[model samples]
Target chain A: MTMKKRNLLLSIIAVIVLFGVANFVQLEMDAYIRRIVNLCMIYAIIGLSMNITNGFVGQFALGQAGFMAVGAYVVGIFTVPVAMRPGVFYATPMNPAIINIYMPLGVALIVGGLLAALIAFVIGTPVLRLRGDYLAIATLGFSEIIRIVITNASSITNGALGIKNIPPLNDVRIIFLATLITFILITLLINSSYGRAFKAIREDEIAAEAMGIDLFYHKNLAFMISAFFAGIGGGLYGALLGTVDPKNFLFTLTYNFLLIIVLGGMGSITGSMLGAVIVTAGLEYLRVFDEPLELFGMAIPLFRPGFRMVMFSVLLMFCVLFWRKGIMGTEEFTWDKFVNFCKHPLAYFTKKGAHAE
Target chain B: MEFFQAFANMTAASFAQHMANGISLGSLYAMIAIGYTMVYGILLMINFAHGDIVMMACYFAFFGITVFHIPWFMTFIGTIIATALLGVVIERAAYRPLRDAPKNSVLISAIGASFLLENLANYLFSGRPMRFPDIPLLSQNIAVGGGVQIQAICFVIPVITIISLVVLLHIVNHTKTGMAMRAVSKDYEIARVMGINIDNVISITFAIGSAMAAIGAIMWGIRYPGITPMLGVMPGLKCFVAAVVGGIGNIKGAVLGGFILGLGEILIVAFFPQLSGYRDAFAFIVLILILYYKPTGLLGETTTEKV
Candidate 1:
């Protein structure tokens, strides 16, 4: 009868249909397709974590991979069998100390999240004291240090050999379910009062501080929460691959995450989900870039050789130059927004689906 | 033989070696540092894409020599001019639009441009490490005294650095454009209201900064003898730290900071063998210390903001 009710009903129906179709695809899809889906979910978790710091709390953090390294190593240590882990970070001899700390999958993920969050708390304490680009540089420094520590602390991280036999997470169904749950929970939390406070801080820190929001504490909270999610993502990644290496968490890891946040629109939760999916798929779609691209019967190497990243940069430049607000801006999905979006899906499609409408 | 002995007795060979390496490396860093300082002085924005721009210049050189058949003599003007143009274009496209936006947006955009450029390089180039061609001009060694041999390449570096500084100094102090730049940096609104063309000034600043980076990039390729998509990340970051150390907005401070950091980095490595693994850490430690002790840097005067 009402627009809100109608929109809610449509959303429910749409989600149910999506889930039903996803389940069907999971049952029938090829291994490659399933792997792509898993990667998308993993990246989405990372994007969500990054969004907390960059999008919500407005801090420039470029060292996410460093935190992910903490998550990956911690989770790998717990998830991998004792004998295999020693093979990776062999310098850090298994003291017979942590040999028996194998955790159940869920607990391992949470442990990974909690450990990363704790690390963030320590890092953010002094670093976030500075504002703007200085914070980015500090966080980036933290990530690099984490990487070096892992490399040098071979006894702990096995240096470059990394952790292996982490147990294969072949079930796409589990990933889909986990991703859905995390997405829903985050979406709900972002709609809550706490999320509003986060947004207020993002909009104007001075204004937010004037309103009595403790800047340091809230920033720390946002950072830890982001790291928590990132850690979980890393844990899940370790489980999925059944092996982990320090190199996997290079500075590049954070760059891609930055791209996801910027392209999706800073401070938009739904945009994060959409960005993760699109970017994940886009990485695959770019395989065409590796092939000598056939353009109107002319094999254009421009589209073929390293052209994917060129196009990606072109897209990035286009976004910055033209669409500075990104695809979503700071706008969020609402009941009225949903109705308005659904009313003209074509126009919505033309402009990034109306930023969560 | 007596003189050699006397020279050795007077100065520890190791000490001389460390000092030489420090000064050489510091001078190299000083060159890169100028790019970072110049941009920050005008825009109050750290050009994160700068390192990638330097890296891009190296790739361009690599392509010119290896792929496109360009002569080595022409590479200097070729790469610098091209990169300088790219710097201008980047500022126009990525940075100029967000002139009035919150500082964070431009910061993020610069990072995005960094990723975009790196990935672009990775895609086009092999993204793997490539061996730099040996230029006869750079590889020659001249023994100055005793067994102390100076690479012909080393002298060219400092000479080039001095020349670059002179050019930049002239531009910043003498040009009408430089005056407009100083005006903009002091107060953006006042500059805008004073009928200065804000975008043009910013673009020129970016172009000058980029041209300097191009020279630094070419020198890095020649001296370092290896190239990768990631080559710029470390130097870009280190030079940026150097810029901050020198008092970001001060040109003279950048050169001073670069030399200090460059020398400091090498000396730390030389004295403490264990710290070699943490060579990168030294910069951050210095940055943090500098930030704590004198947030404004060596040549910078501290300012109380009008909140």
Candidate 2:
């Protein structure tokens, strides 16, 4: 009921949640789980980054996958063993060049973001004027183009063999700590004046333009912000997977983010977070199709494959028809919202009284 | 004289090749673009899942032929029915309720539907690519000029495309259902007041468009002969670009746009392989250029905002 009590309760809850996550994360068995966590953190970063454009700024961009690929390739080329780069791009560095070039992960991530920003800058000037569906399609095309170029630049990208053996940032601690720091920075940024400006554009771009928000500057910034995080996410993914393929950034992969953004609630930070978890976990959990099955009396063989995707699609259809507003319906989970949620979990998840935006 | 001869030969070959490629690709683009334009005309949502639907249609056709061992003609008929039914069902289940929702909500739902389809297909059919069976009927070649070869399928394709276009034109211009579609696209509330069943028009639009996608899928399977759950991804986006480039809500514009995009792709491939890597880039660039120059598209009229 009171602000102080609510703040105290929230702090206690945050500590407990963090503690639980730490304990839970330790339960994973293989190196891949740590990598997946790193990947998810990167996704959270990129999803948050995309939130600036699609979520906060209200521009529908399908280019995040492309941007992430760019970032991944950038980090991959720079950090991969020259011996591994196939010696096609340049004469094998006299020494293993990536080692001497290692920057702090913070700096590298920023560099990745900046590079994405630069790419976004070039693409945005000509493309941002398109509205709604047109804008979305254009961005989608741009991502595909990015993938195409990377795939074709064989001398540089190794012509689809992809850049492999990039130095791994194997510490879960780094990822966990970095993810925490990123969550803080993005949350702060979204609550600041700039975030409000983004929301202004989202609510009504025409009105925002009338309000002198300088649509070009704000949008490019949002795109760059999104691209930057995507780049960082890519760097982490590359580090985790140790192999970077142009195909990895396919439009199909982008669909997952689109699904997450949609399922979470477009234009909502909390929604993006909730979405990333459900989707990433859903991809793995859908392995029931990969497992042995028995329907009725007959022994259905294992890995009837593609079964999960069918179920996923069914779930998606159900969500759209029955839960169109998605999990949060653009509602943010502040302390007050959370307290109310704790009191009425059903209403919170069910989005009771929530209507279409 | 030598320079003139050389220049003339290259220009002729490139231009002819570009034209050939454009017409072929254009016909396919036109097939899917029509679906986009039709849906946008009535629903105002971009049907994000249409690409996957095109893909699903191919698989459906595959199932009809390879799995059912049906005759090719029967496969064609069955696929049309199945895809048309799917179109109507998707509209009713996913989009019908959101008819009046915000544009963004519909867009997301369309995306959900798309994922649902692609993932479903990946589950039912493996992610591994399937070979598209060749049609014995259209398996031949034709020659247009000195030293230039063209597939016989090319000529048959245009004929089928034109016939379909003529039929669609008749349906849109001469039929009563067409009138209801036009009325709904122009204004939903007013159409409801005028006793038009908006749901029926929407379903018809989706069914017709999806049927066209099925035909396109069959043709694409013939030409490329490979099927993947994700196959529709690029074509869907490119065709949407064609629809937008021509005119989002204009049927004729979508057809024309399809040709231009098809030609554009050919020219890019012919002239610049370095840029070939960025082949898909052209669609977005054209979309941006059009949005900047004429957001209403070539044949599209400017939409009026509701007060």
Candidate 3:
């Protein structure tokens, strides 16, 4: 069979398997396990969105949390049952206009995404002009500003009491499908001319500008797209947690997505997907370290509540220090590469070793 | 008429009190901003961990006084030294390896170092906020001219900030080490080629910056009386903003930026009581405005990127 045809068949089979597993988890798994799966997919979507700016466009914008908050708030406001509005907004009444508004989960998610995109457009106009750390800091400031505004705007955000009873969204199928669509859309975009323009800008802004790439336009485009998906991811996150508060979108929350992108190759789609699974699952697995453990009736002093976070930080440092390129290092998981890797796993390591040397 | 009446009731004494408060706060910010400016002046990296160093220094001071029963003066001295050592150690571990890496990688490493410090502090000290050990001499409220009362440390803070700034200026301008820092900042490769020990200079810069952070932390702890692992994040960010606003890499500019920010914050709240909830957002709004109007910062020199 031709390589193209074989890859298509493989992709079809993979999708079928993904749905089958998602169905199994939805039907058989407990809420706890189902939530984790949903979280992984949501993270993957968020991670991919972040990659559009940070990885592909080479803009070190750290405002994902802000965009996510926008998306989450949008979803929370629109999707909450009209009956629950009074209860949720007990601290201060929600905006009179939005109080009675209710939309289906899918529509709410899209609206959330679009509103996030609009905010991104407004933010990107001024912020994208900054370079390097300045851009990072400015975006971070905007995120904080957004949070502060949300906190102070009591009537709108319910004044940090946070909108609760977001219709529970633990369905694995929907989130998985969202993740898949996001991955595909991003993959297609990244292969297009605009993606090349972004990569060129990333490689050398001066050269890209010289090549007639409208730096501002492309940067804004990449940023808005990233924010749009981040908003959707945030919406899913709100639904999954059944709560949407300003606290959930702290600047520190952006670090989780940062960790995922850095763990997976920064620019690699599949790596982000893999990273989402590993990081989400790994964090859950790492909870054992946080819990008290008595080995042979000798209580270990090291096992404590905060140790897991310390260890996580250590892992982040280790990754940046030793594995700078990450697992994928800008390389996508093509079928050819996978087949090659399967055929000669040892050879791959040796080649990598040689490169290191 | 009500709005006009409220404005009319503001006595000159109260304004003076606010000014005093603003200057003290500005001086604290200036002191911390120096750490950010010096590091940026030398390494061209943000040292995201600088604020965390202040938190660590506060914790060190807390432990030295409370746990070890050391005197406040000695604890401050010891905390400064230990924090300087910690700064140097952080640079060696997290930044040194990434010296030749891309800017983004270095930034990631710096952020990683910051997170590590925060999490480590959390693990060791727990997430509970600790009361900063009260130094009676500094914490006591003193009545100044016209019955305007302020903490004794408020007066001491600006004095210390000015003295340090003068000393730092002397070190940077009139000393050999400062010359080397300038050269390194200008061109890292050329500085190295000219027989400057780049690593040692960078370490010294980190040490001095961290020491300053310790001083600021001590003053901050005394004034605020609360210390937590997350304490550094906001101040660190604000100081960095101050440094940027003053045109990062310019020491005096940092001071100017700090004062402006400090006074601006105080005056805003004094003038607009209803806007106090948006106080944290004020610095950011200033940042965005400054970035838009004068991207090089208030005192920063404008330079075009070379092809």
lDDT of each: 0.80, 0.78, 0.91
- Candidate 1: where are CA atoms >4 Å away? A1-22, A86-96, A294-298, A339-357, B1-11, B62-74, B144-148
Model 2 stretches with alpha carbons more than 4 Å out: A1-33, A81-104, A294-298, A301-303, A336-357, B1-18, B143-147, B304-307
- Interface root mean square deviation of every model, in Å? 2.1, 2.1, 0.9
* lDDT by residue (tens digit), candidate 1, A1-357: 987688779778977887786777688999888888888888888888898888887787776898888877777778776656556545667646677677878788888889989999988887777778888887888888888887776655667778777778877777777777777777776778777788888888889989988888888888888888888888888788878887888787787777677778888887887778887889778878778767688877566567776776676666656676777877765667776777987876778656766
Query: Which wins on lDDT, candidate 1 or candidate 3?
Result: 3
> Which rank order by DockQ, best down to worst?
3, 2, 1
Pairs with steric clashes in candidate 2: A55-A267, A113-A228, A306-B122, A306-B123, A307-B123, A309-B119, A309-B120, A310-B120, A313-B116
DockQ comparison, 1 vs 2, better candidate: 2
**Winner by lDDT:** 3
- Order the candidates by TM-score, highest first — what do you get? 3, 1, 2
- Cα error, residue A97 of model 1, in Å, equals 3.5
Native contacts retained per candidate?
Answer: 0.53, 0.81, 0.81
lDDT of 2 by residue, B79-164 (tens): 88899899999888888888677776677678778888887777768789998777776755566776676776777676788889
Chain B TM-score against the true chain B, each candidate? 0.93, 0.93, 0.96
TM-score of chain B of 3: 0.96
Best prediction by DockQ? 3
| lDDT tens readout by residue for model 3, A225-323 | 999999999999999999988989999888888889999988888888888888888888899999999999999999999998888888889989999
Per residue, candidate 2 scores C-alpha lDDT tens digits across A1-357 of 689787778867885687567546756547657556656666676677777788788888889888889888777777765444544344322234443454544566678778888999999988887667767878888888888888876656665777767777776666666666666777777889888888898888778888888888888888877887788787777777777888799876776677677788877787887888777777777787767777887778645767766776677666666777778877876787767777988886567457532
Encode model 1's per-residue lDDT on B239-287: one tens digit a residue: 8889999999888898899899989998777766666888987887787
* Tens digits of lDDT, candidate 3, B118-145: 9999999999999998899999989876
Alpha-carbon TM-score of each model against the true structure: 0.89, 0.89, 0.98
